[model samples]
Target: MTAMTPTHGGPWTEEEFLALGEDNERTELFDGDLHMTASPTPWHQHVTTELLVALRAPVRARDLRIHAAVNLRLTPARIVIPDLTITTAIDFEQRIVPGSCARLVCEVTSPSNAATDLVLKMHYYAEAGIPWYLIVEHKAMTLRLLQLQRGTYVEHLTAEPGGVLRMSEPVTAEIRPESLLPEH
Candidate 1:
C-alpha cells in the first residue's frame, strides 16, 4: 500500500489513519490526531539493530516474535510505531499488531523526540496495560527497563555505560549500554 497525503484539517478516524499506509516517515494516531516525525538517525538505527540481535536468542527460544518499527495499535484511536516490540501474537497478515499482544515495547531516544519517548509514549503504553517498557537513552548511553505497576511504569533496571542489564522475564538477555552505540 502506498502512503497517502494526510489532510490536517480535522481529527483522523481509524479508517482514515489506516489508509495513510506505511512509509519511511513515522506517522502515529493519537486521539484522532496525526503525528509525523522525521526518520531516525543512523545512531538510533544502530542501537535498535544491536538490541534486536542481543534479544533474538531468548525471544526465539520462548517462541515470541521481535519486530522493529511496525504499526502497534494501542487502541482503536491510538496507533503507534514502536522502535521495537516483543510479542506472542504473530499475525503476519495483519497490518498492525494489537497492543494487547505486546509483552514489551521499546523506544530508543533521539534528541528530536526524547520527551515523546520518555514521557508521552510511556504513559500511553502503561495506559494500554503493556507489561514492560524499555528505553535506550541516546545521549546518556544508558538502558532503562520499566515494569508496569498499578497502571504506571516504574523503573526496574538502569544499565549505565559499563554496566549490564540482565533480565530473565519478558526475555532472557544481557545487554551492555556501550555495546548498543555505533563505533565512532
Candidate 2:
C-alpha cells in the first residue's frame, strides 16, 4: 500500500467514509485519510481466530468482550478497524455499535500494515487513551505484548513457542505461540 498526503481526493471525513457503510472492502482511516487493505490471508485469519479463542477464557467469565477485525471509531477525524479488540462494555449490541467503546485494541502484524500497526496505529490508539495494545508478529514465530503508559505503548512482555504471554493488573492471560501460527 502506498503512503499518501492530503489532497483534493484526500482527507476523507468520518461521515463520507461511514456513508460507505459496511462492505466487503476493507478500509482504514489514518490521520483522517482513507487507505484500503487487501483481503486477509489464511495466516491472518489463523492468528485472528486463535486470538479470539485464547481471549475468550479471560473475557467470557469476566463479562468482558473481545472482537476480531471490527470497525472502531476513535474520533470524529479518525477511525481504526483493528484485527482484534477487547472491551469491558456490558451491552454487547449497544457497545459494538459503530464509534463506541473500546478498552484494548490489538493488531496482528502483516506485511502491508506492520509499519502502520507498530508505529502509527500504536500512536493513535494510545493517544486515544486505550488501556492496552497488542502487537503479534510472525517474525521468528513470536508474539509481543505492548501496554500503554502516559499516552504511549511500551513493551509489556513477549512469548514464543512453548512459552505463554502473561499480563498484569486489569487483565491476565496467556498466549501460546503455537496457538497463533497457521496449522500445516
Candidate 3:
C-alpha cells in the first residue's frame, strides 16, 4: 500500500501522532509521516496468533516477554505496531517500547500491505537495532526467521508449509508452518 497522507501535513513528533486519537484508521508514524491501513483479514490474524502461541513457550522459558500488535517507538518520530513483539523483561513496562529494548519483531504478510511487512519493516527493524525479525507469508505458505548482521537482516532460517521452523538463536522453538493455515 502507498503511504497514507497525514491528517496534518507534518514532520510530526511522537506526541503529535498519538494525539490524533483512535477514531482514525490504524495509523503509524513512519519517518514523521502517517501510515494508515484498514483492518487486516482473519487469515492474517490466524497466522499471527499461531506463531505467537508457538513462540511463547521458548521466549518465556528464557524469561523474556512476547506481545501482539503493540506500538514500538523506534524513534521520537517513528512508531510502528508490529504483529508481535519480543523484549527483554526490563523494558516490558514501557508502553511505547524503545527499539533498543526489542529482541524480535514479527510481521504476518498481508496482500494489501505486503511491502510494509516484507520489505519496509525489515529495514525499520534493523535500523532500530532489533536483532531478529520473523515474517510469516500466508499466501506463499512460508516462514522466515531473519537475524540482523552488519546492520541488515539475513534470512537465517526458513520453512515451507510442510517443514517445521526450528530456531536456536534468540530462543528455541519448533513451529510447523502449515499449522497456521486458515480453516476452510
Candidate 4:
C-alpha cells in the first residue's frame, strides 16, 4: 500500500485513489478528481500538534476521540484528509471515517491551501452535515469556530492572537490562538 504516485487519471475510482497509499504529499479525492498539495510546513505541523494536545484531555473525558490528519469520507466520490477531527467512535477496520460520525473538523490554513480550507472544505463539511468546523489562519494567527445552520456555516466565535476562544459545544475547551504558534 505504498506508492509514489497514483497510476490513474481523472474520474478515478475510490479504489484507485486509495491505492495511491501513504506518501509525503497531501492527496485528496474530490468528485473523482485527484488534488495534491505540498507537504505542510513545520509551522503548520506544530500548530496541529499543539491543538491536538490542547483538546485531547477534554475530548477524552467526554468519551470522544480526536485524531489528526485522518481521511474523512464525505461521499462515495469525495474524501478529504482533515487536519483534525473529533469523533464519537472510529471503526478501526474502515479506511475512512464517515462524515456522519464527525463531531468537529479543524483545518489549520497554510499559505498554499488557504482558499481550499476556508471556502471549499467549509462548504463541503457543512453539506455533509458536520456540526462544527474550526479554521486556523496561519498569516492572521486567528481561529474561527463555525456552526452549521440550515446547511450553511455561521461564525460562532473568532479569536485573534492574544485572545481566547472558548466553546461548549462539540467539546468544552479554551484555545488561545497565539499558543499554537512556535516560540522564537
The TM-score of candidate 4 is: 0.94
Per-candidate RMSD, Å: 2.9, 2.9, 1.9, 2.8
Per-residue accuracy of model 2 over 134-169 as CA lDDT, tens digit each: 778756567777777887788888887889888653
Determine which window of 10 residues in candidate 2 has minimal summed lDDT.
90-99
Question: In what order do the candidates fall by TM-score, top score first?
Answer: 1, 4, 3, 2
Off-target runs (Cα >4 Å) in candidate 4 are: 1-10
Best by lDDT: 1
Question: Model 3: how far is 146 from its true place, Å?
Answer: 0.7
Off by over 4 Å in 1: 1-5
Residue-by-residue lDDT tens digits, candidate 1, 49-165: 999999999999889999999889999889998999999957889988989899999999988889989988999999999999999998898899999999999999989999999
lDDT of 4 by residue, 1-184 (tens): 2124456655977888888788788788888888788778899999999999999998998899999988899987899999999999889788788888999999999887788899899888998999999999999989999999999999999999989999898999999998988999
lDDT for model 2, on a 0 to 1 scale?
0.74
Q: What tens-digit string does per-residue lDDT give for candidate 3 at 1-184?
A: 5445656754888888777776435678889888888767777777888888988999999888898877889888789999999888655555577777789998988888888888887888898889999888867888899999999999999999889889986889898898887778
Native-referenced Cα lDDT, model 1: 0.90
Predicted structure 2: clash tally: 0
Q: Which window of ten consecutive residues has the lowest lDDT sum in model 4?
A: 1-10
TM-score per candidate, chains pooled? 0.95, 0.86, 0.92, 0.94
